[model samples]
Target: MEAKSERAERAAQNELLFRAVNEQILQMTERFRAQLSDIDIVCECAVASCVGTIRITAEEFVRIRRETGTFFVLAGHEDTDVEDVVGRRNGYVVVRKQAVAADA
Candidate 1:
């Protein structure tokens, strides 16, 4: 079993990676303002092996960015022990990592 701290570290790293991908996608999307619609974003789950992507509208992504602790993951990717489901969409779920993990 993974230790709590290790899990938190992994989760934090995944979140950071997801954020980086999001930023890249945002930059690319900005160049096509007239065609902007649903954007593909990396699933920000703690699972290091996960390579899934979630599609969300640009507005939804902006709302998630308003809060640092929140993340968008595939519908079933949430680790209940380290995060809580704050919202649900058609193909994805919004999770807010626990304080300890969120701060990592």
Candidate 2:
């Protein structure tokens, strides 16, 4: 239905915005060479109102970023209708947007 596509589009836009923010965070972290044991980054969820943070190491984030269009979110924050869980860590999970499913 049209409503579902609209929801998916909205979710994609929100997630993309968060992903861009997270990329900036990573750039800052790498530029400073902070060597932090763990960094608190915003949850890359689709919820526009979500202000949650997920704790993860710089290296871990880089590893997850190796894949295109992936996001890191809190375990229960993932919306299966929009993304597919690709990896799971202690407190977070990596997800990839499902092209067909999300648009369906």
Pick the TM-score winner.
Answer: 1
Those runs of model 2 whose alpha carbons end farther than 4 Å from true positions after fitting are 100-104
Where does candidate 1 stray beyond 4 Å? Answer: 100-104
Residues 7-65, candidate 2, lDDT per residue (tens digit)?
77888899889988988998877766665667788998988899999988888888887
Against the correct fold, how does model 1 do in TM-score?
0.89
Return the top candidate by lDDT. 1
In the predicted model 1, the residue pairs found to clash are: none
Question: Candidates' TM-scores?
Answer: 0.89, 0.85
As for candidate 2, its clashing pairs are: none
Give the Cα lDDT of each candidate.
0.85, 0.84
